[model samples]
Target: MKKLYSILTTALFCMLFWIIFVLQDINLLKLDSQEVITGIIVSLIVAYFTHRSFIKEDPFWMLNFKRLGSLIAFIPIYAYELYKANWDVAKRALSPKLNINPGIVKIETEVESEYGLAMLANCITLTPGTITMDIVEEEGKNYMYIHWIDVAATEIKEASNTIKGAFEPWVRRIFK
Candidate 1:
């Protein structure tokens, strides 16, 4: 079952790659026959090479269909929030108020995997006015040091939630 799932996932990604290439018109030969043959050869090579790593652990967990559904579901809402953040940043820059309280705060991350930690860091960096400075693991827990443009209350949990609410759940589904 695991091997089957892994092969399927690899095939899916290969199909995705072929689609991208076709859409981009990147095939060397204009002939459909040549393109199909090339795509098949590439997919087989990629699948064989990538198959082992794909199922060594939890490939199905990352391929969670429900999580993919949720991600699609959240796109519009997340886009709106991102737009709002961008406007807020622009307004703050233009306003005389200059409401920035830049500070570095240490926050705990519940995500146990390295992939999750990387996702958390990227999430913080993606959001306006926050950047993950460092991630330190101690006694099997990740502690991230983050720089925030506005730091209200010195609570670590609050800082942690900023990344969590924005992107953690989706990342958890994808990589945890």
Candidate 2:
């Protein structure tokens, strides 16, 4: 059963990857037959090695509509944060004197699942002005050590709230 689920998951992932690759032009109506065939070949090769890693305890978890919806919703929020952070970083860069109060701050995350914690760390790293230095599990709680370009607050709760605004909630919905 596990092997069957892995195989199916690999096939689905391959198909999705092919679709995205072929639709890069934003024209789904026209697809080249040669490209489609090549995509399938490449996807199959990738799936062969990666399928096992993708298999979750719940084989049908990927089919959850609520999780998909959460992922979709997260895109816009992430984009907004990315844009805002980029602008802030650019402004700081262009200034004569660097106004950054650089420091490492520890922030507590309620995300218990490994996947959720990883996603949260990645989201923080992707945003400008912050990089996730490390994730430490202490006393059954996950704490992320983040290097912030400007350390606004040092307190754990305040730092966590400021750094993880909107991201934690969306990640919880998608991965928890």
Candidate 3:
């Protein structure tokens, strides 16, 4: 049963990719008989090869609609943050005095899973002003060492809120 579910999930994702990229149809229309047959064949083959790898310790956890919804919502928020970070970095670069309080600060994160922690680290690193320097686990709690161009607050809670407050909860939802 688990293998069947894994295969189905893999095939479904592959078919969706085929429809979007090859068919170029968001509505999934305008697909001819040959294209449909080809997509099904390709998806099935890919699923057969990849199904075992897809089913981890938790088979259906990642298939939750709520997590998908959170991911979709996070996209726009990330874009806005990216835009603001770019402007901030540009201003700092072009400034006359170049006032920058550069230091690495340790901030605690509620995210426990390695995947979730990695995602958070990548998101912070991708942003312009802050870079995730290291991730440490102490007493089963995860902490991120972040290199900030300007240190606004030295307190850990304040630093976490300032840097990852916007996306941390969303990431927890998506990866929990």
Model 1, range 70-104, lDDT digits (tens) per residue?
66766775677578778878888999989888899
Model 3: how large is the Cα RMSD against the reference? 3.1
Give the best candidate by TM-score.
2
Give residue 3's error in model 2 in angstroms: 2.9
Which structure among the candidates has the greatest lDDT? Answer: 2
Tens digits of per-residue lDDT for model 3, 46-133: 9989987755545676779999899999999999989999999999999998979999998999998777888999999999999998
Better of 1 and 3 by lDDT: 3
The digit string of per-residue lDDT tens for model 2 on 1-176 reads: 77777767787788897798768875777767877787778777777788777765666675799999999989999999999999999999999999999999999999988788989999999999999999999998999999999999999999999999889999999886
lDDT of candidates 1 onward, in order: 0.74, 0.88, 0.87
TM-score of each: 0.75, 0.84, 0.77
Q: Against the true structure, what is every candidate's RMSD?
A: 3.5, 2.7, 3.1
Q: Please identify model 1 stretches exceeding 4 Å from their true place.
A: 1-8, 26-31, 47-56, 173-176
Error of 1 at 33 (Å): 2.6
Candidate 3: residue pairs that collide: none
CA shift of 3, model 3, Å:
2.7
